[model samples]
Target chain A: MQTTDISAAQQAMADESVKRLAMICWSNDLDKVWPTLILATTGAASGLEVDVFFTFWGLRVLQKNNKRFTGKNWMQKGESFVDRGGTDHLKLGKIHFAGMGTWMIRKLAKQYKVASPTELLEMALECGVRLHPCQMTMDLYGLSPEDFIDGLQPTLGAASFIDMAAKADITLFI
Target chain B: MAYPQDAAVQPPALRIDALGKKCPLPIIMLAQRIGEVPIGNVIEVLADDPATKTDVPAWCGLKSHEFVGAGELAPAPGWAFRIRRSY
Candidate 1:
């Protein structure tokens, strides 16, 4: 009975029904987030089931961002408010030079005909890639449902993401 | 390997111009438009980005489509890939 069960389990593992990609987005910097979206879009384009969980600083990418403060409390507001930027206004991880490198990178991407991070994020949505916001992070940052762009999968916790990732053919953290 | 015939044998039903698009955009365009053509028909993708060489074929294999062939653009830079809709 044990040998039979082992063979059956191996068969089930071999016969995967879904080519899924689960990615963890842990940083909000443009350079980091850009590749994450690019991979998400590419996986979707290739017909994989793609999920991206935005957590920690990465939640900034999903926020309805502007110059105004965003948190409910003083510490949250003071720390995360001015740093909040959506896909269009992300800061570079290195050589930012007070936004000059960010500007240059955007221009360079345009000149090379490479899609901007914003465009890639939109493409990820258009391709039906499932976007999941981290619930704990949302609470910590005092964000609400309306803060994100439309067409997202419901919020997921780290445990929920791990459950999904266990069944995925590929998992990435970016 | 000898290519089945030439461009005459497998004329494309549609031509997607992704001349300036980079990386995954070309593949995204191909994926979005592959359904537009009938099964067994060919779609020619014109891409200037060097990555197209591997991406087009990889996408074809990943999606179970048929990669017909590729050719240089001659006076223009880059290459064109002919893909047939297998399913």
Candidate 2:
């Protein structure tokens, strides 16, 4: 009886199922970008469905001039009420410096054969990684749709992203 | 050494041991190995961490790879997952 049960369990595990994940990314630190991509790509590679909602500085990863922007924005003077230090304040817990991280990603991409940010964005799309920018965040920052890359998906609100997250088997913040 | 005339063709293989590792490691290790496998091949991963149950499948979904399922190992130390590279 135990043997049979073990076999049954094994068989049950071997069955294929689609896992859903909704990732909420709010960091702009460039070093954190690859990990996010790596996680998303890995999930897709493993056959799970993924939705990525990027907000605030996180959009920089998809921006064309992301690498050009350095640490000191000089715009933090009066923005203490909102995120205090701008992108720097909202970076990932593991990575605190956006400038150094952005530089590292560009440097590493060049060192290896990995695609550029633009190419990576295309690759992400090709892999079926759904991307949604945060509407409220864009508006709060006074950013227009033209600020983002062409073909980028329209912005969504936190509620919309939350709705997706509610159904997801996994939700990540990076 | 002796050579067999009827040898079977086998795909490349990789083993990611993420036993006792944390949330992203299991997924990270699998990602590193997935890169080694050619498209249409399989990569095996052994992880004892509970987070892998969710992380591995989620990672697969993001990359379009086929998640082959994972479960507890009886009389053993960890769970094992099989991922087939589709791209």
Candidate 3:
């Protein structure tokens, strides 16, 4: 009986479905975006169904224009000025010398032949990784679906994301 | 352990030199080029990225390819991964 149970368990393991990787991206800093894209692309490349949920500051990356602040308040305007631009314009977390550090990182990445965040995103999309924006955050910021890059899945709520995460083989918060 | 001499005689059908390339690039290059070799034939990937140590095997597992083994490339700073196309 024990042997039969062991073999049944092995059969179940063998019959398991394809692996899934779900990630919650809550930060949009240059440093964070690099890892997020790298992992997403790599995960997809490695045969996992990769889904990245962009929320809060992380949604800034999916915006059509990185420099524009949609908010009406002065603080929002100030944040837009400081965080101007999309993936290419993101600032480093530390030693950000008036955008010089971001420039230097880009230059070094080019020199080393590393894929930039933009390129990684493109590759991830090509690899069939799903990109989802958080609807709650979008509504909070008054952002519509048209404001995001093309091919994004419909904006999802946290509960929907949780459902996806519950079934994923791996879940990450970035 | 000693293997049959015939096992050592077969050379890789394709070799990818990914030295100096960073993570994802090496893997991307391998993914693109693995198709160039015939199925069941072996392809050797030379990569310097530390991540490739795990990444290559993970890719093989995901793609249903065989991860034969990895060995150091003598006189150079990198690894040579041997993968057999399973399908």
Candidate 4:
């Protein structure tokens, strides 16, 4: 009789087997941030267990104190989606010329029927996309836990991220 | 060359050339092609660019395609990715 090891290996190779994905997105550029969200959400929707750890400036996206949308790094001249009623609360101090860019994006989305970042954020949460704010980066940036948007997971450290990656079938940095 | 007249009856093998394309395009193309192929068929993507090494497998992880590994091809100057459509 054949050993069951072969059967176990075969089962391991089966298509329906679950795959965990670890995605690290460290860029704070608003444009870059969305792709990570879209990709991570898409991954979760497609059945891959997904974890996204935001570090450095990337943590700004989840800051409750910084609820207003910001533009991409290079362009620096547009409104983020937050100004278009994407989120319920808007941080007052950060509001500036970038607000117009957010309006433009909303107008474009209305014209093109594209999903707004706010809509995407809702979808991401619904789809079980685990969002991790980095503890080290948060501390380095002088952001307290209260600064993060409500309902997001607490910040994680490098070792925990590595362990998550080790269990993941695939890991990505974007 | 144009697609064969009976292409619908005989599913066309997908060839995604994602060399030099950045970010989501590579992943997007891969996702699109996976849907086009029939289950159990093979799709070959030629991506010489380095990003696909990470992007392609990541896409596979999401879309349920089998990432059968990538390696240097017989002909130089690019890499080949083999994916088996499972969904």
Candidate 5:
């Protein structure tokens, strides 16, 4: 009867459910950020529905990347001037050595033909990795949508991230 | 009949040359290009990075593609893997 077609469609739906990966990027350090993008990109490429929630200092990676420093006031400017938001400006979490370690890592990544963080992020976006910026972090930093790179989902709260992660097969906080 | 692999097989419809590249890079290239070929058609992936051996097949398994096999396809300093797209 008519039930057959409906059941067939349901079977098709059940057979095609995609795996999900939920990642919370909590640090801005280049070392940590590398793994985040690597996993996100790999998961997406492997047909996983991938979501990256950028929170706290990690939200800085979503900013409009460039060499110039940013800030509107004394404290903000001081912090940004000291540590920038772009991928190249991000220092290693340990053994930063006042930028020497940063340069060496970038250099090694290039020599090895490993894509830079910016390139990997772009690739992740290309492969359909959803990028969500934490609303609380954005507001705390006084950042607006204009401050970020293109292709970011509208800012959402931690509860929303929790809802996503609840359904995710793999959840990582980095 | 089981034939010797890579024995006068038809050239793959798509060839992803990822030589001199690093880990996920080669696999990413494979993912991006695998769609260019029709289902059942093979794709040739040339990669020097050691990680390619595992990553490509792992991706193939996850995506339901078929991993044919790998061998030396020279000037690349690495092996060439033949992958058949299943869907």
Candidate 6:
């Protein structure tokens, strides 16, 4: 009887838990970032507890000075030059016409009344989506907490993120 | 088609025109303005974006609002979605 009662209590607790979505943002490409923000905002709007862990190049999305690169290595600096600018400077994955593709897409987005990446990011924040920066990645890139936009939670490691993701109903690596 | 409620008999308390707005904007506007009307009153949203068809209903379900139904808006090239504020 006690075992049955304990099982029932566990079931009840599970039923009352909030649904969660865990997303790992591993890319900073414009095409990739747009979908990440879209899904994050949509998930939050759908009443899911959403957490986004930004790592590697994904941390560029949160940079305050998007055009400037703080990397010490020449290769890292070259990458920063190629991918300069924050969310606004992201280029398309295919047929990129020396920044023209980005311009054309932005124009079409405006014409179609689609929200831009920046706007979607704002919406995601407003919707209460939790944003986390990978501490190890930040150290690799020499990024300080002050470099990121406001409202982000403290930088965390993969272990902590894994723990959170284990409890989530949905997990995606993007 | 039969609507969930007599939405035709009782006019919407507030109307939001989101004809040209795309995904997230129309739904965002609905979230912001649904509170303008009193409880139990309906709000009518006119939109052309295809996402609205699913987004509005999904939003209503998430917020616990009553999604009355959607119908074509004749004379205009758009759809009208009615949502009754439950809380």
Candidate that scores best on DockQ: 5
Ten contiguous residues minimizing lDDT sum, candidate 2 chain B = B1-10
Chain B TM-score for the candidates in order: 0.92, 0.79, 0.89, 0.70, 0.85, 0.92
> Which regions of candidate 1 fall more than 4 Å away from where they truly are?
A1-15, A65-67, B1-3
Q: Candidate 1 lDDT, tens digit per residue, B1-87?
A: 223585548678999999999998999999999999999899999999999999999999888898888888878897889999998
lDDT of 5 by residue, A101-147 (tens): 88998999998888999999999999999999999887677677777
| Order of models, best lDDT first | 1, 5, 6, 3, 4, 2
lDDT of 3 by residue, B1-87 (tens): 121243246678999999999999888778878889999888988998998999899899888998888888777888888888888
Give the poorly placed runs of model 5, Cα more than 4 Å off.
A1-8, A11-16, A67-72, B1-8, B74-76
Q: 1 or 3, which is superior by TM-score?
A: 1
lDDT per residue for candidate 6 within A1-174, as digits (tens), equals 999999999998965576899998888888888889888888887678999999988988877645477566887667667766467766787756887887899899999988998888888899899999999987787667766778898888999999989989999887
TM-score of chain A of 6: 0.84
* Model 6, residue pairs in steric clash: none
Q: CA lDDT of each candidate?
A: 0.87, 0.63, 0.82, 0.64, 0.85, 0.84
The most accurate candidate by lDDT is 1
Please rank every candidate by DockQ, starting with the best: 5, 1, 3, 6, 2, 4
Interface RMSD against the true structure, candidate 1 = 0.7
What does DockQ give for each predicted structure? Answer: 0.82, 0.15, 0.65, 0.10, 0.83, 0.58
Residue-by-residue lDDT tens digits, candidate 4, B1-87: 122233324343787877654444455457655778788777777766566778777777756677766655555566677777886
- List candidate 2 stretches off by more than 4 Å: A1-16, A66-109, A112-119, B1-87
Encode model 3's per-residue lDDT on A4-98: one tens digit a residue: 99999998886576789999888888898899999898887777889999998898788775437654567655766665646766678787788
**How do all the candidates rank in terms of TM-score, highest first?**
5, 1, 6, 3, 2, 4
Pairs of colliding residues, candidate 3: A66-A85, A67-A85
- In the range A35-149, model 2's lDDT, one tens digit per residue, is 6766675565455687888887675555444323222234522332333322222233443465465556566656643444344455566557888888876655555555455
Candidate 4 chain A, run of 10 with poorest lDDT? A83-92
Share of reference contacts found in each model: 0.86, 0.24, 0.72, 0.14, 0.83, 0.59
TM-scores of all predicted structures: 0.91, 0.51, 0.81, 0.49, 0.91, 0.85
Q: What stretches of model 4 exceed 4 Å from their correct place?
A: A1-16, A65-106, B1-87
